[model samples]
Target chain A: MIEAKNVNFYYGNFHALKNISMQMEANTVTAFIGPSGCGKSTFLRILNRMNDLIDDTHLAGECLIDGQNIYDKSVQVDELRKKVGMVFQKPNPFPKSIFENVAYGLRVNSMGDKSFIAGRVEESLRGAALWEEVKDKLKKSAFELSGGQQQRLCIARALAISPSILLMDEPASALDPISTSKIEELMYALKQKYTIVIVTHNMQQAARVSDKTGFFMLGELVEYCDTKKMFLNPDKAQTQNYITGKFG
Target chain B: MKHTERELQSLKEEVSQMWKLVLSQLEKAKQSYFSGDIELAREIASREKRVDAFELKIDSDCENYIALFSPVAVDLRLVLSLMKISSTLERIGDFSEGIARHVIEEDCNRMPPQMLEDLQLDRMFDMLTGMLSDSFVALESENTKLAGRILAKDKEIDAMYCNSIALIDRFLSENPSFIHCGLKTLLLIRKLERIGDHCGNIVEEIVFYVDAKVLKHGAKQNKE
Candidate 1:
């Protein structure tokens, strides 16, 4: 389980998130939904310490994964990133073969011999539902694949390291409906072994894929509940108005 | 997907219009049944076509709304409840029209004041009218406070129905010569009872739209 307690995040002088507290369970999909600039992406970054790469950022309160604070100095940043992988909004595959893209993380870590790396590559590709499409053309450049397939390759790259927690920031927003649906379906399949958290602008996508949904506004966590209740009858009027498109 | 707010508001108005038509249908049918007015009965029958038309229009509109906008949360609940509410209202319209037709065909003008009072048929119509009216008011205001009270009235109608069945059976044995009118009276009573049930169904749909609670098939409003 992942938990954030009274978290207040700041970028330079700007307070991006205020006193946000939430819990996300293992092997389930949790979605964060709000308008742009709502600090959802910033919070997702905090889980893997990706914010550490940004300059002049400050954090108050504890972010815990399995009862240990990830921000603790004793924890290595590179190690934490390997355990908590992320897939960004755009499908960014390097100028290399699809096989090498999945093997990149393992190769950087020098995880095993060439044969072991190849097995892990195939396993991660199958886990992301991309193995069949790319198996025959494993040596072909990743740019040869379509936009949706490229996104899946990025996901396979993330899963290659066997991360327990996966953070996705609008992973399907740039893709078409068919491609978006493929990504959504892939999220459902991956949640069987990985705890997934996604930031999305699409309310229906959140409703369709998530087990729990959190509604944010103005950097504040407005309401968090079971997905059905959040979509069907949210307790707060602000959440209702936002979801119903009555927000002023 | 665009202009969702205006489309939702327009859908609400359309459902309200259909609601008013169904209410007027029930009221006219009740008046014709009690007064044994054949002309008014014919009018009620003719207006049944309009209720049918409203049902068809509302169903298609909801489908189109879903196709175009893909509503969620309360917007989804409103469309879903409107679909069921319109269907229930249409069924109530049918029962009311059935009562009107029975009046036009039978000689209920001589249905004996004592027998009518014993069956509480007048009180049944009064409660059914109140139930339908209250459901519309609740829907208009988007409040479920009226739902509990409206649901309670259905129980009263059910009690009257149970009492009337025994009274009608006793009357049939005593007045063998008036058997035809007695059987027709029983049929009208049954129709009124069904109207009460359908109105309660509308109340349930109202509660679902306003509070997102499903109170069907013996489910109580949790209110939690």
Candidate 2:
């Protein structure tokens, strides 16, 4: 479970997220949707402290994972990140072999020995829904796989760390339609184990793949509710206008 | 306006045009029946085809809008309500055409004036016309405040329909020679009653579209 309590974030004095308080349940897919620069992705980044990587960025209020404030002084950033995995918009894989790409996470963490890393690599690939495609070519270069395959490889790389929550930032935006659909299907299957939170520009994809949808606008969360109600009969007129393509 | 807004406006206009045409058909049915105008009755029957054409066009257009736009919230509700309203209007058109046929087929001229007055045919026609036209205004204005009043008018039509049946039986008992014409008049009244019910249905759809409230199958029961 993940919860944000009155979470306000700033990027060098420009407020990017304003008083956003929401809870995402375990094992359910939650989607954040809005126009560009609306703070949906910013808020998602806040969940795993990805914003800490940037200069002059500050966050106020608690970002809780399982009721523990992750920003606490005693909390370890790397340990927090290990429990929260991320997949970016573009598939940025290491220029290494396919097996090495997945094994990279476990290797860096010194997680296991040779046989342990091999079994974990295969399990992560299967978890990412890319095992069968890349099973026979484990030693081949990661660049040999397609863009969609590379994205799934990144997902597998994240899974190799054994994270509890998966943060996807437009994970299918660069892929073709068929590949986008495959990624959407993977999200549905992945929710059985991971509490998936995704940021997307596509409204229909959010409606299709999420159990809960949060609509953000101009650094403010406009509405957050059931995906069906959000699409069919949203409570706010702003949400209705935005979803129906009436907003400027 | 946005592209979707323009398309929705065009769809609303199409449904409004069809509503007006169906209203004219019902009006002409009343005119032909009372004034014994066989020519006007024939015109109503011929224009029936145009009403059917309107329904087919509106149905397909709504389908295309859904496929092309995948509308949500109000736009989605409007498209769905428009489709159902068009179909309900087509059914009303069929009843009007059926009434027009009765005028051309039955010897309505021979029916005694006193008997026609007793049947309260003019009152029933006026009520149906008012109900249909008021529902049209309700939809056009995008205001469902008139829905309650418009829906209540159907109850009056139903009461008249019930009374007309008993009145016809009394008239038949007194004058057996007029039994055939009397029974046909009862059927005509039944058609008007049905039109009233369909008008209620249209009002329900308008309420659904404009207010996002489902007024069908007894609102209270549905809410419960």
Q: lDDT scores for all predictions? A: 0.89, 0.92
Tens-digit per-residue lDDT, B123-218, candidate 1 = 788888888989888989988888888878888788888888899889879887778888888888888888888888888888888878889987
Instruction: Evaluate chain B of model 2: give its TM-score.
Output: 0.95
What DockQ, on C-alphas, does every prediction get? 0.73, 0.76
DockQ value for model 2: 0.76
Per-residue CA lDDT of model 1 for A7-32, tens digit only, reads 99999999999999999999999999
Judge candidate 2 at residue B181 and give its lDDT. 87
lDDT of 2 at A155: 96
CA RMSD, predictions in order? 2.0, 1.9
DockQ of 1: 0.73
| Candidate that scores best on lDDT | 2
Q: After superposition, how far is residue B121 of candidate 1 from its true place, in Å?
A: 2.3
The deviation in Å at residue A231 for candidate 2 is 1.0
Mark the regions of model 2 whose C-alpha exceeds 4 Å error after superposition: B107-111, B220-224
